[model samples]
Target: MKPPQLTPAALAQIRTLGSVLRVSLEPGGGCGTAYAFALAAQPGDLTHDLGSVTLALSPEVARVLTGARLDYGARLKPPRFRVLAHPNTPHRCACNRSFGVPFPGRVTPECRAYQPMLWNLPECP
Candidate 1:
């Protein structure tokens, strides 16, 4: 699978780091799942070499992050890193931390929270 594309700003965010970016995901608040970032590497992690920095995506995390991009916004208050919108996650929640439908084993409440209309109608919520 293609790795998450890192924008210029995202690359800069870890320019000074000696460790790789450890990518993971966890259940979000009634809204699918969310990306979790760290600075480390682990065994069996799916790694993507991005020249300046490496992204070590956990087995589960890699699954949900398909077609995503990493970016950094310096102008926002407190200045932070964020994921750019992508076709695979059109139902991204308002919090900007969650997206898509919740993982299986989880139910529709998570999916419905971001896209209530999807469940009620023929379109995706």
Candidate 2:
């Protein structure tokens, strides 16, 4: 898979600052998945070198983030990292904090088993 696409500004920010960036799959509302960006890297994470900066992602998130784009929003009040939807994934949840993984798409086991009846979501086939 192609490495994640980072805007030039984001690329420079991390490389110049020598920052460690981590992306992970967090448990979301209704047992969905949410993307999280942080400065801490956890054990068992897979790392990718982006020039002087390192990008770490958990195994579950790595599967979903391939081919996704990461851009820095410097204009936002506090500035933030943004990610576009991966090609194979569809719409996000109604709350906008979680995402739906279509059939055949990979998801963490927690998502498949988390209070399934409450969300009216079917278990993976």
Best by TM-score: 1
Candidate 2, clashing residue pairs? none
CA lDDT of each candidate? 0.68, 0.63
Estimate the Cα RMSD of every predicted model relative to the unseen true structure: 6.2, 7.2
Off by over 4 Å in 2: 16-18, 29-31, 94-97, 102-125
Q: Residue 88 of model 2: what lDDT?
A: 34
* Candidate 1 lDDT, 6-121, residue by residue in tens: 88888888775664888776666547666777889878789988887998988765655678788878897877767785555567767777776445544336445454223221
Candidate 2's displacement at residue 19, Å, is: 2.0
TM-scores of the models, in the order given: 0.74, 0.67
Task: Score candidate 1 by lDDT.
Answer: 0.68
Q: How many angstroms is residue 29 displaced in model 1 relative to the true structure, after the best TM-score fit?
A: 3.1
Residue 45, candidate 1: alpha-carbon lDDT: 83
Which segments of model 1 are wrong by more than 4 Å? Answer: 104-125
